[model samples]
Target: MTSTRLSVIDEIFLRTHRGYGVPIALQGVWRTTGTVSRDELVRIHDRLAVGKLGRRVGKPRIPGARLRWDLSPGSLPLECDTEAVENIVAWADAQADVPLDPQYGPGWRMTAARLAHGGTVVSLVCSHALADARGLIDAAAQSFSGSAVPEPISSPGSDAADALRMILTVLVRSIIATARLWVSARARAELRAFATSDSARTPPHRVRKMRSVVVDIDASQWDSAAEVAGGSANALFVSVVAATMAELGSPAVIVDIPFRTGSGDANSIGMATVNIRGDDSPAVVRAACKAAFAAPVGAPAGYPPEVVQLLPHRLAATLTSTPGRGEVLCSNIGEIPPALSTLGPHRSCGLATRAIHPAAIGPLPCATIRLSTYLSRMDGRYTLSLVSTDDALVESTEELTAAVHRALEKRNLAGTPW
Candidate 1:
């Protein structure tokens, strides 16, 4: 038997869910050429539930112990909208508002709607605490290929015994971490000045909603635009995002790029940071990206993972700082699996993936980072997904879509919005 524990990042996401009631879920939308029947939707949903997304986070038996995964079947049923909608993108965005519980079980949901014109829009929303973007994609690909679900991995010992061992290990690591912090002058200084400004805080009175826009560009045109801009596809993506943020009145742009670390953990992603300007050419952005890739990946927080995991959710939230105003997350999902292009007897014409907060209501928790962009290549086209959380900046979907078009025009590229 093998033991599986929650990673530091996963633990942080869990804290956010329990403390703030925010269901930060990853959503993937697929536009198929033909309508998917209810029976087919159920079939796909059952397959996904048996995959990696089937597990839930099991709380530690005692305080200061680690959290484990409870291998069990999901209970959330497939949600189907009987009403046919013309705008599939809008329908997909509405599905993000559905509640998903990561701790209890069924940390994911699959919804489908038929397009009035002629196709089907299917969306799968998985709790971030359960899986990241890549993990979700992998699970979908495996399910589509009719792969057999692996047997659940069991714990080596009792929960009490595991707790005892974890507590002892954490004690030793915490001592070492405390000693390092005491000796490092920079660490001491940072701790003394660890506080956010009032302006940086998310106002509780601000009524904000998450609005998303999907744009699809021809593969040949995207490639040609990237070549003309003197950068690779990823660099072009970053440039467009930076420009869009700049158009929204950002002074400086700091982009976080998540790279795969090959770890089998649910959220096995290492982040790299790069700084760029709205007017910077794609070549400049490309250079910055190249430099960031070469640099070492840093820890996500100031404190050690062992220490943070030991603290209560309220205290742990303070340790995990929110992204600043001009910060943007540019996740390039790269090429998607061909299996995902076909879902339940229909071929997908376009696909988009993004992270959404289902419980986004009165006071946004991490509202400083107003915009996030995701890129995925499928079916000879590049689908760019944009999620804007700041009502003050984006105001409306049309404004956000217009800004994107303007940014693309500067790069001599054009796209069709969904």
Candidate 2:
């Protein structure tokens, strides 16, 4: 089938159903080293569409979305301008700031312009609520790598439901197992009695503006740093972010980290977004993160991996199966690929990246941060973006951005790559 409608991923669907939408964007500059062909453009479009599901049902669509690649022909030559590429790039960056229309569909847009010089700069803007930022970058890298044309149509799968399903599934099983481990018949019976007697429990808190940060480190350096610090890259990243919040005097914080989905189908990769809320104590945060990282990478190793333990089995399953869960998402789209390098003769290129928050019923933030690695002859660099709405926090957005950069710099992880 050319297209099959499936449910929107948890965060994405929620965003559209409400008024807010995801914005995914990026800009890149590539100096023309070899001949440019229309075939290359087609291939890039096909790759972009590969993973997108239908808006309503979240069903998979072959060649996911049509990409528009417009070029200013050489014949229309104006005066040769060295910074012509920069002008286009600046406009592309401005595009990233525009709000999206949730009713239209997946919030992604791209523009590629040939510069006055032989080089070119490409800009991509997307909604964060639709897909994770890293996912978008990965797809872009694959598209730009070569002229490997994708098969026009591919299988449609229910990939969006994976995150919600997996978490809920794990949660329920954990609860059942924990109950069997810790509760005796009398205790269980007494709990049941208390359940029947207690009434008027507090309402579930509304989703609030998610507070988040973005830091880019050399993907290569991350491992050694983690090993030396006796922590994983994620742990270190979170620790820095948490430390920043502490410095700001925040009593509580919620952070969501993207968990890569194992499925081969592009869409099958679910967002195992993590939340580090409910545990306000620094010791709890540090210990919980440490324990989570200790587990083998592939194994379901994080501590209390199942949250369903907190809910009844039936309810837990229902929540998992259902589309919406009021949760803030934190994700890191790891380093950009080396293939994106701009070598000699390739003078000017544009690399554009953007992030947008998802809209949900409550005030909870559907914000995210993504990083893309960049290379220059003398420097190793990456770009970081943080997406949030004014309703979510009292802190100034500039303050948050500064804190992220400061935190990353303190660890000697990132700075001006130029």
Candidate 3:
């Protein structure tokens, strides 16, 4: 018997056409309290790898044909010091001159980063355009026997938490479905704001420099809001961000909502990244999100082909709006496990995460707001990173944070992802 160099699914990565070259990095914070072992870490890596074990089709930007399905590499080190993590990210602002390899099935690369005191920071940066946010979290949960996996239709909420994970199988299926769905009238409607607006008709001004700042905020704010709004923590955070954009002058925004409904069908708890593009009206965006979560029970359908094929144009239009595009890009990676703190006994638990966008928006890209909550704690960490040549935006992280806080205070909760 010969050892399989790579799984059959892995070989398909080079053939995937959905711009599979995109890189997605998600960091898992595990406390060293119980003696974290390499075996445990590898197990987590393996589970996530298994989640991407399916066949492939056309070729994507990443090189190689035989290894295409997931294009994720096994966990590798981020190659920098604890303090360097911040610097490395800041440097990437001008250009992503950094080297990235997606041959791994999860495109899931790892960095066994060591903190100043002790312990390890396991970071997995995969592609967001390919995988959904929920799927990323599910991969982490499987490593530690987390409760949320997709199971049979035996019980309710099974869609979000059951564990039938034939990852690759569902991935290809979702892609095909999404492509087909996006190729219809719905896709046009979904992108109406971008396509119809005259302000979005022209090309955007060239970008001069791209600067980004990443900070960790407390999730307790989200928890309190979720409690009051009666919605999932993720939904509340997104609503808050949408509301903030509304106040900032852009009354329209597009948010990528991840879907994990396949889990209910005994499929792997993977994510289908969908655009719940809506006007930045706080009330409108909130109502849309709330409805998606409040749906009695049903997985959101994949985007059709029309939607997929026209996404670039839609994206370009959105970016072309106004003297400059919207001032905020908010992403809420809901409750990370408290164990994600990669520090030793001397350090308090902390989780570090980053979100990326395409490079088309000139030297300076989009401004981003990231929020993550923990199930065990009332607080959540909110990081605001803005990409721009604007001096005022670059200088004041506190101002952005304060604005976000106020937006959350007035968010309405009545929307749905569907």
Candidate 4:
């Protein structure tokens, strides 16, 4: 019965859903080392509704009309597939494209498939309206709900001053935003001209479909690579992306790194957005990641930045990129919750491989790389997914994956994890 107020940034996806065809769903894929059965799956679903794990409350009683989670049973569909792992993966991938409709009355979906290959694959598909890439993954963790409850601190008699400052900031930013709009066409033309030599600048072909390539790396080796880079495991993700883009011969690309709200509370999750330049060196990657890690969250309208999303989704996106924003979105959801037998009757050793199968409608930036890990770092391997609008960019995903491996291995930065 708890309803949360969403921020403008959170609504960016809402706008996108309303205007653009972008699939608003953020997807997380897990390969269970053990099989999950229908009965076991039922228990997990119940837990989700009861708020025993993950969601504070389940899906909204209804969708599209508003944002809410309905605790009713049979509300969330758990896709049951007794087929091969690929089948489960494919189904999970398609969940993002499930059109948003008021008739549906909610924006979340779930799938648990018992793999014929001796494991299980589970997916938590949610409307970007519910959470971002990182927030969505955190949503699957049992502890996510408890930590997500937000507490805002305020002082008495300070509202007036804060309100005035907000008014001024909004007025100034709005004016600038308006001016940019009038000249946006020219800006895009300039970008297009600059892109003539760099094919990566081109948006995906009218095929304007979304696609991803998940790259797996040994968990232990990944940790060592991070150590050598003098950064956390997440930094290594930034390094590979920056290195790949540099190899592509682009001058510079701004990587939008949206940091998740540690609590993963839906209301507070949309307030942070980080933009860092990507370049040729792992050192630069290390620096950018550090800055992002330290950057402060922004507020809009005396609240979280979700206000930015109030504008049309495409417009909201353009505001960031029209001038000189980087088109590549690279991020890593460091590690996900390990498999536990409590959630089911399976052996629950841990995950085999993980995939971030993000579903979107079209017109993607040059490219995107999303990384995630499952199980403990000791045995959890990283999953890297390359996303793009065009098939050409999709083709490069493999090359880039190979390139990162080569760079790490060649530097001897990648060694046994002890």
Q: Lowest summed lDDT over 10 consecutive residues: which window, candidate 3?
A: 1-10
Candidate 3 C-alpha lDDT tens digits along 316-418: 2233221112233344555554433332232324443444333331133322222221122212454333333334333343454455455644643221100
Whole-model alpha-carbon lDDT for candidate 4 = 0.46
Which ranking of candidates, highest lDDT first?
Answer: 1, 4, 2, 3
RMSD to truth, every model: 3.1, 10.3, 11.1, 8.1
Candidate 3 Cα misplacement greater than 4 A, ranges: 1-106, 117-120, 144-221, 225-236, 242-285, 288-331, 337-348, 352-354, 357-418
User: Top model by TM-score, which number?
Assistant: 1
- Top candidate by lDDT: 1
lDDT of 4 by residue, 257-373 (tens): 545555533533422223433444455566755665564333312232333433445655644222122355555555555532223554443322232323443444332332222
Determine which window of 10 residues in candidate 4 has minimal summed lDDT. 56-65
- In every candidate, how many clashes are there? 0, 44, 84, 17
TM-score rank order:
1, 4, 2, 3
lDDT of 1 by residue, 1-418 (tens): 2237776677766765664534578989988878878887787787887787888888766665678888767667787788888987788888877667788866888888888888888888888888889888987887776773853767734667766776777677657656778688876655554443334433522326877899998888888899988998999999999888877777467777888876666677767778889998888899998998886344322544556666777776666543222357898988999889898788888889988877643455544456779999987899999988777778888888988898999898898998
Quality of model 1 by C-alpha lDDT: 0.76
The CA lDDT at 296 in model 3 is 22
